[model samples]
Target: MIGEREVLTRAQLMAGGLSRRGLVRALNEGVIVRARRDQYVSAAAPSAVVQAVRIGGRVTCLSLLQLLGVFVFANDVVHVHIPRGASRLRSPESVAKPLGARGRRRARLHWWPLSATPPAHSACTGIVDALAHAVRCQPPRQAIATLDSALNKGLIGFADVEDLFALLPRKYRVLRSLIDGRAQAGTETLMRLMVRGLGHEAVPQVHFARFGFVDLVVDGWLVVECDSRAFHSDWAQQVKDRARDLELAKLGYVTLRFTAAQILHQPDDVLAALRGMLGAGRRKPPPRN
Candidate 1:
């Protein structure tokens, strides 16, 4: 019955079959609630996930991040990349404008449009979306992580990475390389910087005999563990990590662990301790089988 009900136009309501007086009477009686002119969401309907969907019903970039369960800290207005040549004012209040188009009025809440068409496939959408936000938002590391998750999960193919990189501004050169180098995981990237800051060569993520696969190996001898609080806080996982560390010790691998905060805020201390370890010849190999 509700589906079949016609949306009465202002003129139609004034014409009598759906009278302006009747519409006013319904609203006063709670029979209908005005959502927007020509747009009415039922009062009992669930709130729409407006941020997750781009204008014109496109999927949003950060919403894709949320869908992929990637960690993101931004809670401000959602970022949406409108393709060039899209209807500029799809909604009068829409936050969309041409990205590179000249002499356009830019507005907050709505971002300028990019010149390319957004991919409809999930992975391509994710990569393009992250790249677009990275360009506007200025956080290289978070952008790189978003790109990494999309790539690692096989959402975006390797071939597309360069194309995305080319679209970025030159100021983000180092960050672009870091993303290209596959330092997709924030934990891994931070740990990599910490090791380098400490004057240690960062080893690739490798399989450790007891610790299973570890975060990063420094000088091929010292195992550097980047512990995210969420993972380390689990009692069972913590017990398992302790057991793994003990085994790693017995096998002659020295362990140095840092929390996320230590890597982010007090990285210099991590570097100093790492420098000491490096200077002390911490390169003893594990016992051979």
Candidate 2:
């Protein structure tokens, strides 16, 4: 086995039952490729992982989170984790050449010391370390969303949250209370934060007897739905959403739907609209028939 990320050192491969001859045979047959003198990766390894290893570090931070299927705000470049005090970094294209020699830098390197040693054949930093670095890499609100996403996806548990906080500076501890694993999407997380910033209590994923769970409920009557294109682009989904809104309206709940773009890129405008709506007055739901 090459490893979960499909990368392993020659020694690791040997220990996993690949004899020296088998290793050579694998290399010759293109089953594996040498990323470095002793570092070997399966031919099917993720390019980002291979690239990070070639660049003399492990994939980490937002880049690593993205690879792990976590909700990362952005991943424009590879984020490599090089040990503190490391030197003589090599280019990802050709390890012989020094880093930055080929052309523009291809990766964002983090020189922070790792809190714990990664697995022997890991092509990426541990999830906790990646998350610790990720929170610092993103803005405060985005950081909280990232944490919420990780928790919601079951990638990390509540106990791991404390470990992640321990790795961060003291000031970041304040964000601990803001994380809510019930948020199913990054946009929902952002929207919840916006509502809270306006002094409104926002409950996420509230289920009703007749209807399924809504994204958020603010002040008990205002329903906030974060519609990402991935789930809402189809006409059928749109029809269902409209029907749900109509049903909620009958129950005296006002639904405000926001697209992912509006929630992420136009926060001020979205917040302003929400502020206006919340200021109007709360709509009390009618009594049961």
Candidate 3:
């Protein structure tokens, strides 16, 4: 049963036939880890991750996003949600901000708690609660990217998204429309929002002429590609990308590629290029209602 959270209390270890001598041996060999205050977790598990739950807080927000392989910018803070009025959290080093508010910059503490966190899942916020915290606290771009990644991974479904919005504060509900599974990366969502914010419709991961999906298509003709340096650093991928662009060009789609840095850091240049192309095509952006 190593799959079920992989943590154990000392009592659990004793009940499972681990003798005191065996416990001592495992601890000495570094095969078992002390998750603090009478709790024991596998050596492979991060101490803080186990301690977060052991200290009676559920991990949430950017911390959970990083754990779930979603697109979050940083994890300087260990985000943990404690039920209102509980003060069991104890890590001083990472909890950089002065304690009080929930959305503090580092080692965030979400004070809201909805239901009993089942003992089986106590170490982390339940998926829904974590998503709610993410939506309520993050900027729209960050929120949508995490949502899109979760949707793409089938970690959450359409109904779940609706439920997440219903659980969020009124201010965050407006971002529901921007949550799209077709966005493959945070950069894609950021670029799409930039284009749409300027009144242009940009569809993400659009497939053309059976040539697999491109990163985005704008105004039904301009293909905008964002190459993340982390994934597209080699000659082979570059060659394949160019080949795809040429194939799309044959089908009347003009492809414009940008690096992830350009998409995130150089938004002005990206917008300028997009506006120039839109003007050249004589395409008027559709009116938004």
| Best by the TM-score measure | 2
How are the candidates ranked when ordered by TM-score, highest leading?
A: 2, 3, 1
TM-scores for every candidate against the unseen true structure? 0.62, 0.92, 0.86
Task: Give per-residue CA lDDT, model 1, range 1-289, as digits (tens).
Answer: 0221122334544554656677777668755544334432223321222322223233345644555555453433434444446453333233352222221222113244543644332212445645555445636555665666566666667667766666666666566555533443566675675566566678646675444587777777788888878888799988988887788778777878888777667767877777787788766566522
34-133, model 2: which lDDT tens digit per residue? Answer: 8876888878888788788888789999998898788877777788899877777778777677788341367888888888888766788998899999
Pairs in steric clash, model 3: 77-107
| 249: Cα error in model 3, Å | 1.7
The lDDT per prediction is 0.54, 0.86, 0.73
User: Considering only N, C-alpha and C atoms within 3 Å, which residue pairs clash in candidate 2?
Assistant: none
| Residue runs of model 2 more than 4 Å from their true location after superposition | 4-6, 19-25, 101-104, 285-289
Local distance difference test, candidate 3:
0.73
* CA displacement after TM-score superposition, residue 121 of candidate 3 (Å): 5.7
Which regions of candidate 1 deviate over 4 angstroms? 1-49, 52-63, 73-76, 82-112, 119-126, 180-184, 209-211, 264-276, 279-289
Worst 10 residues of 3 by lDDT: 92-101
TM-score of 1: 0.62
